[model samples]
Target: MAILSASDRDAAAYPIQSLFVPFPLVCFTLALATDIAFWQSGNVMWQNFSAWLLFAGLVFGALAIVAGLMDLLRPRTRPLRPPFLSSLLYLVILSLALANSLVHAGDGWTAVIPYGLALSAVTFFLCLVAAAVSARKYARLAWRI
Candidate 1:
């Protein structure tokens, strides 16, 4: 009988568990990038793209949160992964940002756009940090086990 390596075992158990957080992280990054481009070019298409990105980020972020929560609730998962808390925070921040963006976009309120962009940027950084931390934790745990 062949024995599975610790890393292999961990991978088998977790499968795509870690991939969940990256979805929102990437989405937010793209959203921020699109927003910046739109601001620079002052193009209607880029503005529309930025808005779409924000909405898409919200959808993906919500899904990522659900997936992360499910992973956290699993019996074999780590109970104290930093990504879990960070992801939760990311969700809240992104939701607020999305709301602000929607209102601003709908009413052509310029003031809300800055605030929304700022909030989204903060959440984007948080998601990046969380994803890195979570990956590191999983790697360490897998190596140990």
Candidate 2:
């Protein structure tokens, strides 16, 4: 009886609510790894992988940003600064890096891969820090609520 009841409760909570951190962390790490591989290998495979990773990162990052904004806009939710300016700056840098990577991928400009990868690494780190800070702030606000 207890086992059955526990299973029922678990089923009700199938989709865990706090999955925010893992998604971004995975995207950031994969993107960085692909970028680094492209930088080191100079292989077409790595270049392709990096491009896909960049696209995935952009999509996931955009979703995360939208979710955060929605949370901020929620009634009675705590006000967060959103780090919009910093995020935007990083996005611009990332976009440029991605563009460079794409352009140079076909032109035999192997050096551009590392440049883009390095920029992506820095941007990912910044994003991680921003997410941590935002999570902490949100936790506090959630506690108060």
Candidate 3:
């Protein structure tokens, strides 16, 4: 990090929302991996892991959206905030994760194989797409940026 001169304190500052971006991305991505592990080992433990991860992702993702919105609405920070399209994409990513969490709420193998796993895959894919769309900026799944 560069040493900030007193006059430059206002410069190179990041949005508070950007600081929360990595949590959801890591959580959701790990949830997908745990889903695969559940599929492979048929372990109830993996499913439980996924449940917690999804929940964590939801929590952090919500915080990120709120922070982003706060930044966007602030006159001084508006220009530094993410675009509406970026926020929209983050919402979609969260929606998919919420649906995936619901799917994982089911019982046994059926809970995962066709549906839960599918949802996880879809969510992961959406994250990748959003990241790509944002030119890999930390803002939407842009993996939760």
Number of clashes in every candidate structure?
Answer: 0, 0, 3
Tens-digit per-residue lDDT, 1-145, candidate 2: 3455744553343212134434644665676787677677777676676666666666655665566566666533324434465456545644654564455455443544646666667757766666676566567755876
The true-versus-predicted C-alpha distance at residue 28 of model 2, in Å, is 2.9
Off by over 4 Å in 3: 1-10, 136-145
Off by over 4 Å in 1: 1-11, 15-17, 78-84, 107-113
Give the Å shift of residue 95 in candidate 3.
0.4
Give residue 50's lDDT in candidate 3 (0 to 100).
Answer: 94
- lDDT by residue (101-124, candidate 3, tens digit) is 998888898888898898898888
Query: Model 1, 9-53: lDDT tens per residue?
Result: 655565233565566567667767766765666555655665776
Please name the candidate that would achieve the greatest TM-score relative to the true structure: 3
Off by over 4 Å in 2: 1-25, 76-112, 142-145
Task: Count steric clashes of candidate 1.
Answer: 0
